[model samples]
Target: MTEKNYLTQKFEADRSRLRGVAYRMLGSLPEAEDAVQEAWLRLSRADTSGVDNLSAWLTTVTSRVCLDMLRSKKSRREDALLEGGPEPSVSGEDAIERETILADSVGLALLVVLQSLNPAERIAFVLHDLFDMPFEQIAPIVDRTPDAARQLASRARRRVRGGDVLDTAQTAQKSVVDAFLLASRTGDMAGLMAVLDPSVTVRVDAFAGGGQSRELQGADTVANFYNGLAQTARTALVDGAIGAVVAPLGKLYVVLDIRIENGKVVEITAVGDPDRLASAEVSVV
Candidate 1:
């Protein structure tokens, strides 16, 4: 094959992997594709005669693109934001199976936390923890030393690990989360009513829907909606508090950040934004 053809073939092989990295970094499918295409553009224009590892180079370039995109997200996120279509209804065994598959991927709560991170921390964590890249190589992408990169990953790791809710001492909070999960998984309306306060409120992030479900209120209103619908949810610590994480296959799909008072759930905030979900730390049940 000619030199140009050889380069094209090599880049195509790495495109999917590069796209995965960008998706994890940006949390948006369209943006991830953009980043990957940008990497292709850079590769097309640059000289790689001395490059030892094409995969590594592509990852760095894609990461840089995502970092720039993330840095500029404040203005872009509002305009480009989108969420899943209306949540599909599943019953009995179907819900269980769907949850299991989704859990196998990244948990939604974790994504929320990842989104909360600065560009450097996000890239450092995604490369080192998710993609298994070495800090030595990750350092340059974030303009940090290898040691600094390692520290960034460490901080991100610590946050990913469960927090105070992991403590057995927080029994009351745990009980609330447990009740919520049991009710959700069992589709028990009575159980939901028993645990939720009369004035309970449920609010999902804007990406969930800029309208109606944006804010669902009243214990009956919220419980009626959630009852028998969260078959995949499990008790977990979300951001140091007791709550539920919907991850059937171990990947985060949604984070139910709950607030309980007097042994009853008073508030539940569901965050579905991928960038925000990356930052949430959900404890294993």
Candidate 2:
């Protein structure tokens, strides 16, 4: 058999798995098929002489294609948002057929949650958690370190489980926040960094800062902001989410609305406005 023939046969053999990966990444039959086709086109044009595992290489290529499509879709959605109107919807027989295909392939609830996640998080979570792909494999695809890739999947996992996290996941989140509080109290920069997402963001309301509302981004910046602070902060459940609160002499002074993903702190909102504080249901954990 010719080399081209052999390659074609191998690709055909892996087509099912590739389609599955793309479908999960995109959550749309048409887009997934397009991504798979793109992968095949790229494979036909590239040098596969050094590739030891054709299946793995194909999976990676297909995943990359899906990621690009997802990013482009996200960009367009953002543009639509700025334009101030909702995008038109599809309907009739075509829409029904598409919906039937998707519903048969994936659970509606899971699909809804997956659609809520960002492109990178969706790819990481679907690949690692769903396809059993490793973080080492996912890291390069998402342009992140292995640890960060792991965190990406971790964050996605939490979101998939929804707002009322399972006891185990909630316990895990609490530990991360507790460590963060310890690090903050002791001015431990490295400790804080360890539990914080690389792109963590912190926003403080005017009431929280006595008149100046501000936002901080990046782990280093957030860690710096928290270093040597929160000495009186207590671990609390902010609206059923594990967070921290500062109440001196039994009067609520500030509430830290911490959001954790994949065992790391991703976002923190400090609320100090009396009206805001009055509405939030907070209790020390």
Displacement of residue 53 (Cα, Å) in model 2 is 0.7
TM-score of each: 0.65, 0.51
lDDT for model 1, please. 0.73
lDDT, residue 25, model 2: 82
Model 2, residue 170: distance off in Å is 16
Give the clash count for each candidate. 31, 1
Q: In candidate 1, how many Å is residue 48 off?
A: 1.2
lDDT of 2 at 97: 67
- Residues 1-285 of candidate 2 have per-residue lDDT tens digits of 977678778887887688778877887765676777777777777999999999999999989988898888931222222132222243577755654565446553355456657899999999998899899989999999999999999888876654453488778988998899999989999999999999999999999987999999999999999999977676766666777777542246788888999889999999999887767655334
Tens-place lDDT per residue, model 1, 159-196, is 66653234554677888878787887788889989998
lDDT of each: 0.73, 0.77
Off by over 4 Å in 2: 74-102, 163-285
